[model samples]
Target: MTAASRGILRVVDSDAAEAERNADARSESQSAKDTAQLVELSKSGDREAFDRLVRVTHRDAYALALRLTGNAEDARDVVQDAYLRAYKGIDRFRGDAQFSTWLYRIVANCSNTHLSRRQRQRHDTLSIHTELIDTRPEHDPALQGDRAELRVRLDEAIRKLPERLRSVVVLRDVYDLPHEAIAAELGISVTAAKVRLHRARRRLREQVLPMPGEVPRP
Candidate 1:
């Protein structure tokens, strides 16, 4: 193609991309408005509105639950519990934060509880003294594990984090919530959220890629 034609094509592509972005922004704005209205109606005891709100938000909620719980079964259970609790407490929601934010907090809390209960059950079933499994990869100059294996290791490390640290790290890193928002959701100070995230990341690095003489956690 001639230089002028190529330039024209590039301009067209740029305009199309910009228009797509604007459309996405408008769609997100409309979704937020719709969600707010649904929250108000649900708070007023409208069951159908609450069901509509669930349909709108369930996919994202399940994604968050899966990230937090690290398994599909546990994630589904956490989501169910979270929504039930939210329904029971909707009258107390008070609109202090976005409905999605509030729902995410409930999901996180439910995941923590579910995982804790599962851990206790495992402990009861297993021997009194549990053995830690060290999952160090092959001794390559570069840790040559594939991306999927690395992700599994990371998920395992996140799962082993204490509830407080796990919640903060997942909110900040996985969900990309700001420290301020995380603190608001968790009802903690921003400083506490930052501290927990730093500690969680440090622990994760230790577990996922231990230095010489350091023990990797299970």
Candidate 2:
């Protein structure tokens, strides 16, 4: 390369390196600030600070609830219920874990309670399946019919998953929670969380992938 070209390349590389370092530093600083401020505000009974926390964490919380409940309305209800409980119990928060971690625990507990109540109600009524199927949206005629068909297939696959495996897979894959956070939320050991997640993924693969003699069509 010419001397001028070499000089330009060196400058570009140095600039890129500096930019990456700055980004890393900024990320660390933001993390520290969020943690410190949240802890202080929560301890001081600052409702607005807690509201800010909700605004930041709500999307992830809702997504996790959606995956667990497998329905938008139920998920919304679960998240709302969880947040209410959290608000009432904030003073009891010991700060032993990250605030998000504590929130996840509340979310999980709320979802579980909702699901248990649903199961009990279903057992008492013969019309439970009718009610669930009735809640599903009608497909629009503008879309290809296959889109609706595929959605039904995917929902069935998820519904077939065992509870423990489903929870891990939903939290890890669907909500993108870290394994450690998932374990803490679920009150399981990290190794157990990993194993459950592995099994859940394997089961999902088996359901999605074609078996021998069943070639997947494009």
**Number of the predicted model whose lDDT against the real structure is largest:** 1
lDDT of 1 by residue, 82-107 (tens): 99999999999988778888888888
TM-score of candidate 2 relative to the true fold = 0.62
lDDT computed for candidate 2: 0.72
Candidate 2 lDDT over residue span 146-214, tens digit each? 776656655555566655677888777865678887787667899999999998777655444334333
User: TM-score of each candidate?
Assistant: 0.72, 0.62
Q: In model 2, which range of ten residues has the least summed lDDT? A: 127-136
For model 2, name the residue pairs that clash: none
